[model samples]
Target: MNHQDHQDHQAVGASVDRVAKQVIDAGLKVHRALGPGLLESAYEHCLAHELGLRGLPVRRQVPMPVTYDGMELDAGYRLDLVVINFNARLFRDGVRRFAL
Candidate 1:
């Protein structure tokens, strides 16, 4: 591979790492501020607010519909938060993203 191509790949990887750290920091901040014993919605809302305060756009309760053979069964599988700049959608169940 060319040197320039390697450098570009390294830069992109670094950027992704930085974004991941930022997201984790934001989540920690939310946990610290709110503490425990709260519902998922509460945490989701706080995380969204925290990310927004950091000048990042956050999407909450995003509809995730499921489609079957010629039919659709959307059992209300909503994404808890879709934080921008990280290329991922953090769910109450787990973190989900496409080909990071």
Candidate 2:
């Protein structure tokens, strides 16, 4: 990657971190209000909607693109959520990978 690309990646990473913090905060609110009685899927869906309402850009079910034999192969590896800012300066690539 060139310098410009590196800068872009850095900017994207910052935006991702910011949005990720917001998502975490929203998730905490949900956990507090709803507790652990509900199923994980239900909570996940609700949190996704809630994050969208907060003016955050979210992409769901994004495929993980891989390069194989000089060809781009989109595997079924999907990201549960991707957060990005309007300027594309900051971005969080995926959330599901971090879920424990």
Candidate 3:
């Protein structure tokens, strides 16, 4: 494999989460099934297949445009994972509030 190919795979390899170990396991399962002969798209589809079996939401080719001054900036990259509305709650004086 070329250096760039090695870097590409490394870039997508994230630290496995204990709570999300199942996700990583699912990815590995896909990898094992397809092996290394297929293209990246095939691997992604297989991974998504496993994730779907686990009732996980998988959005492909999700566009994540950056915004500046209320203008949408079409950056060249997209986010693989976008978790929205994960803000924690804060309670003080018997009042519930959203944490920044």
Best by lDDT: 1
- Model 2 C-alpha lDDT per residue in residues 1-100, reported as the tens digit of each score: 9999999889877876777688888888878878998987787777778888998877776676677998878776776766653453323323323352
* Candidate 3 regions with alpha-carbon error over 4 angstroms: 1-19, 80-100
The residue pairs found clashing in candidate 1 are none
**Two-way lDDT contest, 2 vs 3, winner:** 2
Worst 10 residues of 3 by lDDT: 90-99
TM accuracy, model 1: 0.67
lDDT of 1 by residue, 7-92 (tens): 98798678757667777888889999899999988989888888888877788888877778977689889867776534334333
Could you give candidate 3's per-residue lDDT for residues 27-90 as a string of tens digits?
7788877788888778777777777787666666566567799987889666443222122242
Lowest lDDT sum, 10 consecutive residues, model 2, at 88-97
Per-prediction TM-score to the true structure, in the order listed = 0.67, 0.59, 0.55
**What TM-score would you give candidate 2 relative to the actual structure?**
0.59
Models sorted by lDDT, best on top: 1, 2, 3
Taking the candidates one at a time, how many backbone clashes does each contain? 0, 7, 0
